[model samples]
Target: MKVLIKLFATFRNERFKQEEKELPEGTTIRQVVAQLEIAEEALGMVMVNGRHAPLESQLHEGDTLALFPLVGGG
Candidate 1:
């Protein structure tokens, strides 16, 4: 399966802002994050095809996955 991955905030420093990746049929969000070398604790929000998604959510071909890092402000 192929999915589009979008990284936000500081996460883009580690990975591309957006890119397409080919993964196994049963690949999950956590697997993709792990492959990107992103720490679990750094993840803030996850979205799949415009809907909120969990780390365990399974990915599908043509799906768009967006990841954001926790942000802090005064």
Candidate 2:
């Protein structure tokens, strides 16, 4: 299956702002993060197909997943 991943904030520094990824059936949000080398703790919010999603959320073909990293500022 294939899914679209959108990275926000600092997450985009070392990765594409948005990209398509191919994965086997039953891939989860956590797996995608790991595949991209993103620390789990660095993630702030997750959305799948525009709805809030959890780390264990399963990804499906054509799903658009957005990831936001924790933002810090003084």
Candidate 3:
């Protein structure tokens, strides 16, 4: 399956801001995160096709996945 991935904030450092990726069928959001080497604790939000999704959510072809890193401020 082919899906579009969007990275936001510090997550984009050393990585692409947006790109289309070829993922195997039955892939889950959590798998993609690991593939990108993104630590679970550092993730702030996960979205699929503009809707919030859980880490175990299954991704389909043409899906758009967006990853955002946790934001911290005083």
TM-scores for all candidates?
Answer: 0.95, 0.94, 0.98
Better of 2 and 3 by lDDT: 3
**What digit string (tens of lDDT, one per residue) describes model 1 on residues 32-73?**
999999999999899999999999999999999999999888
| Model 3 CA lDDT for position 7 | 99
The regions of model 1 sitting more than 4 angstroms off are none
Model-by-model lDDT, in order? 0.94, 0.93, 0.98
Mark the 10 consecutive residues where model 2 has the least summed lDDT: 6-15
- TM-score between candidate 1 and the true structure: 0.95
Cand. 2 TM to true fold:
0.94
Write the residue-wise lDDT of candidate 3 on 1-74 in tens digits. Answer: 99999999998899999999999999999999999999999999999999999999999999999999999999
> Could you tell me how far off, in angstroms, the CA of residue 63 lies in candidate 2 after the best superposition?
0.4
lDDT of 1 at 73: 86
Clashes of each: 0, 0, 0
Candidate 2 regions exceeding 4 Å error are none
The lDDT of model 1 is 0.94
For model 3, the superposed segments whose C-alpha errors exceed 4 Å read none
Residue pair clashes in candidate 1: none
